[model samples]
Target: MVYRGPYRVRVEEKPDPRIEHPNDAVVRVARAAICGSDLHLYHGMMPDTRVGHTFGHEFIGVVEEVGSSVQNLQVGDKVMVPFNIFCGSCFFCARGLFSNCHNVNPNATAVGAIYGYSHTTGGYDGGQAEMVRVPFADVGPSVIPDWLDDEDALLMTDALATAYFGAQLAEIREGDTVAVLGAGPIGLYAARSAWLMGAGRVVVIDQLPERLEKARTFAHAETINYNEVPDVVLEMKLQTDGLGFDAVIDAVGAEADGNLVQHLTSARFKLQGGSPIALNWAIDGARKGGVISVMGAYGPMFSAVKFGDALNKGLTLRMNQCPVKRQWPRLLEHIQNGYFKPSDIVTHRIPLEHIAEAYHLFSSKLDGCIKPVIIPDAS
Candidate 1:
């Protein structure tokens, strides 16, 4: 099924995904998820998205077939697919950076193509169907433990992986104070990851009281409602004894409260005539040597800044798309050991037919819809 237009859903039969390479395997998608990235495709923001191109990436499925030369996996294995498809032997993969594999894309691009994305990717179909063909199966997919439910493992591909990457980039340590901006699914996962990484105090900031409350209940992290308390960074500093936090994860990105200060500083040169209040607040909120990890998706161009101030403060800023392959193993182990539960982020479960409704609830943040997992075949 491909998204033909806004709020449109059409089912079309596609060629059965088959094993085309020695390292390939065919997966029968048992469960798939709709991510914020998919919302871009839904809104027609991603160019060159044709009809019948398929439109989902996050999934957990069972292997129905494997190519002859495949190793370390076989038919009947259940697995979680990584969003970024990559060949395991590329230069980037050799450096433990599988997101930038050269061969998987082979389009003169450094990074591999994502499943069901625009032409920037290889136009490979997505997993939101009965079956999906996966390349580099041994390196790109992880077998799920028998005890894990398919829904719980679905996030290993994107959300959980992204949170794990944010945690890594934040360099969270035992007893360090951390603040996560935004209480969306990704922000919730970021908080959970920080807790797993041993942050002494993790505070999730958001305008929605429902989301903040859920974060407190689910992740055992503290919450500060940005709506009620206007000066969030000030409150954070007060809670942290005027030193600000050790790490801050900007999960909200450009959509943050008027492009928060950190974003303004990062993209200062890009901002034209928008309010700079949030930008100022974010800059003042960080401790001298604190780290900021940005994982939000934004438009192509924007501007604002104080590069000299950031440089002088010696703050470490790390930003990038979530490199799914590099973080899946640790996340899987976390799931296996019961240290993290990605399923907690899901607030709604609806059949594929109600996807538009789910999208409404998700986009409007209604009924506390944090992450709604869509079951394609469920009636």
Candidate 2:
């Protein structure tokens, strides 16, 4: 099946994918996920999607075949696919930055290209199909532990890595105060990561009560209902003893731009400057010398930033796609060592045939959707 355009899915009979390069391997996709990022691709919002591009990144599968040159992976191995495909020995990958690998996408300067995305990402097919062709197999796939279930390992590829990246960007430490700006799947994982990173308190902000409640129960984070509370920032300050959090992560991105920025900027700048409000809010939210890590996907465009304020306050801002290779080892350790349960973030599970229904439910916030993992072949 291929997506011709927004809201369109067509099943097409095609030759089974096989290893085209020595580094390539073929995998039978056992479990695949529909990431929030996939929503953009589904809605035709991605800039360069075409008719035949397969759509999906988060997937776990069994290695059905391996290329002759493949060294580590073997047939019958169960693996998790990294979102970004990269060569492990590339200049960037050597530095634990697989997201910017030089060899994965020779045509692009990015470290690596993602599967099932636009030409900007190498135009490689995705794992939404029954079988997927994995390029740079040694670098793209990670062997799953024999004891771990597929659902538990699914997030190790994307969301878990992203949440870990958020925590790393925050530079969190023991007793540090951290606040996550959303309670969605990513936000919940961010909260969990913050907790694992030894934050004394993890505060989650969102308008959804069910999500907030889940965060409070599973991630052990304090929850704030943005709607019920008249002033979210004030509530945060009150909880943190009038000093703002040491780290604030904007997981909500542009969707909750209005309130996200308000909570971020209301504490510092009293002047009503009409500058691009999102930037202002981000700047305002950070306490002096605080860290702001933005993991949300933003379009390729420029927004006004308060560089002067950031400089004066000594704030550190970091943003980018998650580097899976860098964080995979640690995340796997966390999962295997009994310190984290990333799978608990999944609130819904549906078969691939019901993908459209899943999309509707997730997009409409119905059925308590909070990261539904799509089982492509589940009967």
Candidate 3:
């Protein structure tokens, strides 16, 4: 799938990607996913989303070729390439902050490079196509364990890792009540992960019944339909005994539903940062001394968040573009122990040739789509 501007995507033939750097590896994509964050580019909410640029970050593939400097992987190895493109020797990377590496994106002083995002995020092409080039191959692309399923590996590439990171940021303690806003893949993962992190009670909030049902079945959490409730924040407050949840995870980034004005202004009209509805809800619904972990992908522009309330509430707000490689070993242990199924949320499978229709289905939330993975026809 190629971006031809907002709301316009098409399948086009492109040159097979090849290694360009000494530490790069070219992978033949096997499975790819349409992440919730990708919609920001689909709607032109993010800057520098260029025409003909592939828009996928969650992918797993077989390494077709490895650069001479690649030490850990070789050709024929099945690997999962992380979304963050960073040099291992960078200052941030030395400190385990790979997402904020200073050596990757020349356009920014903070954020590191990302695959398939616009120029604002470093212009590396994404892995939506049959072939993708992975940089810093030795440090970024890890061999997929033979026991791990391809779909799970694809989920780990972004959704699962980000969710786990969000939970880690929340610092959920035993007996803590956690509220996860958004029934999307990341939200589901966060809810599930919170349980593994010792959250005593978990609640998932969303408007979609299918998604809420998924939350119940997949995440095993209490569900709340935001549309049916008289007041979402009030309901959350009431559920937490009028105090608020101990921790809240905002998985719905810019395109969250609720306020039509905020949605239109940020998502549709591009007048402000993406909608802060979930983040604000998180802030308003967390207890006086709580944690708000933001795993949602927001645009660079400003959003109308409640900072003063957060300050008054003494909330520890933790957020970042999840460093995918950081959470692998733990996720592997959980999956091996059968704690969670990363692919439980996959509702649709589409061939890469039909990716535009797949994108439409996912973006429109049609046919109960939760997570859609693309199987490239190469293999």
lDDT of all predictions, in order shown? 0.75, 0.76, 0.88
TM-score of 3: 0.95
Candidate with the larger lDDT of 1 and 3: 3
Q: What tens-digit string does per-residue lDDT give for candidate 2 at 1-379?
A: 5787776665566689988999899999888887776765665555677887887888889999998899989999999988988888867888878788787775578436888876677788887778899998887788988878788788878887897899889899899999888788888889988987889988888778889999998888988786776666677677777767889887755342222234234332321112233344455566788988887654332345678987988889887788876787777778779888778878888887776677667766787888888776886
Question: Whole-model lDDT, candidate 1?
Answer: 0.75
Given candidate 1, what's the lDDT at residue 317?
Answer: 80
Q: Write the per-residue lDDT of candidate 1 for residues 50-143, one digit (tens) a residue.
A: 7667877888788999988889788999999888888878787788776677787655374477887766677888887778999888888888
TM-score of 2: 0.88
TM-score of 1: 0.85
Task: Please give the distance, in angstroms, between residue 228's alpha carbon in candidate 3 and its true position after superposition.
Answer: 0.6
Off by over 4 Å in 1: 6-10, 46-52, 106-110, 254-284, 305-308
lDDT of 3 by residue, 64-160 (tens): 9988888899899999888999898878999889899998899889689999998888988898899999988989989888899989889998999
Judged by whole-model lDDT over C-alpha atoms, candidate 3 comes out at 0.88
In candidate 3, the residue pairs with backbone N, CA or C atoms under 3 Å apart (3 or more residues apart, or in different chains) clash, namely: none
* Regions more than 4 Å wrong, model 2: 9-14, 231-235, 254-280, 301-303
As for candidate 2, its clashing pairs are: 100-111, 101-111, 264-284, 264-285, 265-284, 265-285
